[model samples]
Target: MDRPGLADFLRRRRELLRPTDVGVAEGPRRRTPGLRREEVAMLAGVSTDHYTRLEQSRGSAPSESVVAALARALRCTVDERDHLFHLAGLSPPPRRAARHVSPGLLGVAGRLVDVPVAICSDISEVVWTNTLFSALMGDVGTRPGRASNITWRWFTEPGVRDRAPEEERDRLAAAHVSDLRATYSRRAGDSDVTELVDDLLQRSREFRVLWERHEVAVRRSDHKTFVHPEVGAVELRCEVLLTPEADIKLLAYFPLEGTDAARKLDVLRVIGTQTFATA
Candidate 1:
């Protein structure tokens, strides 16, 4: 690894960002020109000491996940992110099919405070979710490994299946399988998608049956119902906004006008914000 170059690059990127750029407030007077080391560490989801060692060029090489997190925290452009990977002696992810969420999409998610919003990859993995989504969906992204995948969870987890109405569950399951099949066709050789398919084929008779149908359909806007534990049943419109690259999508849920779901969503927003603040 180009340790010195990596350190210099990280330092330069960190220094180029202001608190407001990353949705942080300009608090007390700072001795530095940009974000503090601790602030960057917090944003990157790493320990302050760990980030400090990285800046000092004394730590071990970061994993790809760590590098990706740092890239997001630094608000690096696509080229800058690739440079970071290179400096760390790793091949950069493909620009056409990046797994990392874009900063602009994340910014949009941040602005959606009242609605349930999540950023999903092409393969339906929840990369990031807003507080309201967690409140509505029960922290689906916190699941381990492939369990965080929406397709995987829909078929394998009873809790996920239980959220849908009994009559709709079968149709929902079929739609999810068809969506995954479309992704599998698009990214045929991708190991992660392959492993997920293999595992689902083994674990779920329902999935296997649907896969045999060879259905291929892309996800568009749809209506969905959620049986929230606290607020009961709420129906919402699910809208998907594809990024410029079309690799990542922002999935936002909104209540229909003049519906009971709208009132429930307002209650959910208040509860979700409070829960997030305390947590």
Candidate 2:
């Protein structure tokens, strides 16, 4: 790894960002111009000492996951993220998988403090989320590996459907299956697409049946009811906005006009991505 280069890059990027830019509250007594090392560590899911050592140019090479997390925490652009990877002596993530969210998109998501917001990968994996979304629908941090895949969870994990109204469950499952089919078509022969499909087919008889029908459609706009543990039932319309390259999708859940969702979301915003098990 280019230790000095990486250290310089990390420090410079961290220095350029303010607390509010990443949805953090600034302290009245705080005199530091940018985010502290501890705050960056907290945001990047790393230890303060670890981030500190890296910034001091003495740490070992960071794993791919760590680098990616740092890029997101630093709100690096696509090119910047790639440069970071190179400086860390690692290859950048493939655009086909598109796990790295854009800086502009991240900026938008950060400002959406009152609403339930989440960013998903092209393959339906939850890559990032704002606070309210976690409060409403469990935290993205809790969903590791295949658990992070919405379609995989919907099919393989029972009781996940309990969040949605019972009547809409079947249609929702079919809709997600259709969305996966659309992705499968676009990313044909891709290992990321194939493995997820193959695994789901093997694990879920329900998924198998739906995959056979070959449905194709992306869920752009939809109404979903989330039976929140703390907030009760909330009816919201999920609007999907694609990033410029259409590699990632941002899902914003807005309260329906007649629903009590606004108040519920405000409460959830206070709850702030603290997660719990539904079952």
Candidate 3:
């Protein structure tokens, strides 16, 4: 690993960001021009000491996961992220495997405090969720492994459908299967996609039935009714916004017109687990 170059890059990137840029409030006047090292470490889900070592050109090369996390934490662009990988003596992740929430995009989503925003991989892995989204759909992060994967959870766990209206369940299931089928075709022999499909075929008879139908389409827009126990039935217009590389999608749930959905969301924002409601 080009430790010196990686250290320099990390330092430069970290110094370019301010707390507000990443949804942090400006508290207790800071002497530094940008974010503190601890702040970057916290945002990247790493220990402050580890990040400090990297900046000091100490410690071993970061793993791929750590590299990706650093990219997001620093809000690195595609080009910058690749340079980081190169400096670390590692290849940049393939688009699908690196389907992380762009820190820039996450910052943007963070500003939509009242909206339910989530980032999902092309393969339907729930990568990240805004707090409102967690309150609305339940927390994806808390679920373990494939348990947090939207498609896997849908096909394997009936309880995952508790929020969706019973009538809409079948349609949602089919859409998920068909979308995954498209990924399976595009990625043909890629082990990740292949493994998911093969396991699903074995796990769910319904999945096997849907696969047999041979439908192919990417689900872009859909209307969903989330039957939240507290808010009654809340209707939302789900819109998908793709990243520049098209490997990750930003999902924003807007309250439907002419319903009490807007008010319900406002309520959720306030009662946000410990705060308030926007669910």
Best by TM-score: 2
State which candidate, 1 or 2, has the greater TM-score: 2
**What TM-score would every model get versus the actual structure?**
0.83, 0.92, 0.81
lDDT for each candidate structure: 0.82, 0.86, 0.83
Of candidate 3, the 10-residue stretch with the lowest lDDT total is: 94-103
Candidate with better TM-score, 1 vs 3 = 1
Note the clash tally of each candidate: 0, 0, 14
Write down the lDDT that model 3 would get: 0.83
lDDT tens readout by residue for model 3, 199-233: 99999999999999999987788899998767778
| Displacement of the residue 229 alpha carbon in candidate 1, Å | 2.7
Model 1 stretches with alpha carbons more than 4 Å out:
26-32, 36-39, 142-144, 273-279
lDDT of 2: 0.86
* Candidate 2 displacement at residue 159 in angstroms: 3.1
